[model samples]
Target: MIESRVLTQDVFEDLARHARRVEEAPWLEFVHGKLEVKARPDGNRGQIIAWLTRLCLQAYPDRWLHAYQGLRTETDGEGNARPDAVLAPIDTFVGQGEWASPDDVLMVVEVTSYDEDTDRRDRVEKPRAYAETGIPVYLLIDRDSCEVKVHSEPDGVRYEQVVTVPYGKTVTLPDPVGIELDTEPLKNWTR
Candidate 1:
């Protein structure tokens, strides 16, 4: 039996191999040199996501709405990361063709956990990737701070405008989906 000492090349090769071979591993992802297999979020987060999805779908019945949690997002040729919540067009998500590319993503909502580092990554890194791929809207719900930021006006490689929706405020979205999000339900979110 041979136990080989690991090398960077070996590790990179292993990661590359994993990316190459697709599996039914519940949407595993690699972010910042970490192989993260995400289980579903906890009770509070799940409740919020579910409520939001339900309301949004009800508001716009004709539109293609989805409530996908932690779908693999390929950032580069070999890197695959997953966002917390994604709302994409129904056509692409149905697997009618290839997996939904970043451009197909209509809106992305990230419910920040207690981890500031991960929140920072969601705030800083993901906007760049989404903007680069031309995803129109990126909405972030910060549970810790009790704030929401609606990112828009994609300029070059980043979102130029960030509309801040403070806690206990009814937030209004842009045209087409001109529905105002009531923050009343979220008041008891921390409990």
Candidate 2:
């Protein structure tokens, strides 16, 4: 059996450079000096991200929305996290390479996949990380539950306010990006 290796930032960065040379390399993240691999988004997952990206960009033309953008959400060397979509001001991302600090992010979005690990991360782990990193909003589109949850007002490891809506309903985003997202398209999406 092959064992996974934990690498520091410098080592991880070097390996990443080489890994990208391969065809269809899996997404890699550094967590607490350990290398973590993430699966590529499947068809349904990609479609949902694309739709949300388009909708968000159309609603706020001046802002920027990027999929699979890695973020440095913590400072204690735990590692970086790549949200499904990151929303921020256009100017905030200039020249920012593979990973940007959470301070530059306005909102983070995650679309849960069918896998149990993916579900757990999106529902439990990610919210705490995003909130602790001081991200203003964490939007979760849970395919299994067929609902949308808006998490805001991060106080500690959790968001102080949470608003949930079914896939067919609309959810109003809070200040800084006050807009209603029509989740009807999400209803048609399957895992």
Writing each residue's lDDT as its tens digit, candidate 2 over 94-184 gives 7878777777788998888777577657787678878878888899988888999999999856899999998889899887667799989
Candidate 1 lDDT tens digits, 80-137: 4456666654555665222245556667777676654555466776676666555667
**Largest TM-score belongs to which candidate?**
2
The TM-scores of all predictions, comma-separated, are 0.72, 0.86
Model 1 TM-score on a 0 to 1 scale: 0.72
Task: Tell me the RMSD of model 2 versus the true structure.
Answer: 2.7
Off by over 4 Å in 1: 1-40, 69-79, 96-99, 175-177
Model 1: lDDT of residue 128: 68
Model 2 whole-model lDDT (C-alpha atoms): 0.78
Q: How high is the CA lDDT of each candidate model?
A: 0.60, 0.78
After the best TM-score superposition of candidate 2, give how far the Cα of residue 113 lies from its true spot, in angstroms. 1.6
Q: In angstroms, give how far residue 146 of model 2 lies from its true place.
A: 0.9
